[model samples]
Target: MFRQLSERFGRPVAMAILTLLGMWLMVMVTLPQLQMIDYSFRPNLLPAQLGGPEDVWTLSNYVTLFNNEIHRAIFFKTLWSSVLVTLLTLVVSYPLAYYLAKVATPRQAALCILLLIIPFWINEILRTYSWFIILAFRGPLNEILLALGLIDRPIRFLSGDGGVMVGMVYAYILFMVFPLYNAIESLDDNQIRAARDLGAGNVRTHWRIVIPHAKPGIATGCIMTFMLAAGSYAVPALLGSPGSRWFTQIIYNWFFEGGNWNQGAAYAFLLLVLCIGFMSLVMKFFKVGLGDIAK
Candidate 1:
């Protein structure tokens, strides 16, 4: 990899770029993770109790995650919810990506992409809060339904998992789309044409030809979407009711509301482990390598 980069960019420039990247990984990614791991192993200490002899390393933080029924439920709930979100995103994105990459004219595709991107220019918090208005009892959706005589009373959309799922799907749908688009756009049209000429239907053509070619992108998108959804705090917090407790909210409570940094670190580290495991599963299932994803 270094040799290829050096050949393309000249040795000095490639070396400089590699150095910067290495520093970025170490400082921005590796260092914080190592610190979190360290913190996770340490005993929780109050601000007034720092530097005391009782402040020692222990596995209690990890043990607490398992022994506590609430924590265990929340952990599993977050995992499953994230998986659901990834699958939903994939189902929603694949057709759109196929359209943008293969069917639409370049100008039309560009316009579609621009429309998708326009929402993100606003603050994420504001975007999430907009769902509140749409889902609120007297909001536009309820008002419309009432006007259409679909229901006599407004439904409690914001008080259930549906709203959270809707918000999450909307928030992270683009992550899945862009990767799928990149993979599909590179496919040669001849392969698809040949498949069609050979009497394959639209579904078969995509299942046999297009999807296989886009495996790397599918794996990449699933990994990214799953990770982001699993670690999400904002969308759930803003859109979900107290009953719709995401594991990230638990982690936030441990760190901030509960004032238990050590436990929070442990929870955060476990979440990281869950994401890594999911990525590994995706790579294996898709039969793709890390290098393929990096493309």
Candidate 2:
């Protein structure tokens, strides 16, 4: 690997890049996680109380999460909602990605990709706020539905998880699409043609060849989409109703509003762990190995 990198970038440059990567891993990733884990176990102390007898490590922060009924419910709701969002993104993106990767001409695919990326030129917060406006009670969407006689009255889209889910799917759908596209794009077209010529229907061809070959992309897209949806703060904050507060909001409240860093860190750490466990279950169900997903 070092030799290849040196041949490509020269030895000094390759060594410098490797050194930077090592520093990034230690400083940006490992150290912050260690700090958060440390804080999660310690007491939430005032400046004066810190390092005193009452500042000793304890499990009370985590205990609070397990004991609080409302928080427990919110956490579970957020978890399942994120899963639902991931599934919805997969369904929406797979066909589009397949078309881009397999069916669309190069020019057509480039145009479509450009269109998809154009929306991202705007800031994400502004995009989410736009969705918030569109989903309002008398907003354009509800008004359109009413005009089309789909419903007699304006629907309160923001009253529950409806608005949040919509925003989440819209926000994170591209994360699923790009990964699937990358994976499918690398596949050999000959295999697909041969399958079709051998009396295979579209469904069978895809089930046996396309999907299995795209498993890595599916795994990568799902993991990234799920994690982004779960960790998202701005979309839910702007688009969700009070009744549909996300778990991240609770973490924010603990950290800023409640002034309890210990509890906040505990909640944040629990969220990370739960997401990993949930993704593990998903991987097992799909028979996808961690190595494949990582690669």
TM-score of every model?
A: 0.91, 0.92
Which pairs clash in the backbone of model 1?
none
lDDT of 1 at 195: 100
lDDT of model 1, residue 147: 97
The global C-alpha lDDT for each of the candidates, from Candidate 1 onward, is 0.93, 0.92
Model 2 regions lying over 4 Å from their true place: 1-19
Query: Candidate 1 lDDT (Cα, whole model)?
Result: 0.93
TM-score of candidate 2 against the unseen true structure? 0.92
How well does candidate 1 score on lDDT at residue 267?
96
lDDT of 2 by residue, 1-295 (tens): 7889899999999999999999999999999999999999998888999888898889999999889999999999999999999999899999999999999999999999999989988888999999988999889999999999999999899988888888888888789999899989989999899999999999999999999899889988998989998999998899989999899999999999999888999999999998898788878877888887877
TM-score of 1: 0.91
Give, for candidate 2, the lowest lDDT window spanning 10 residues: 278-287
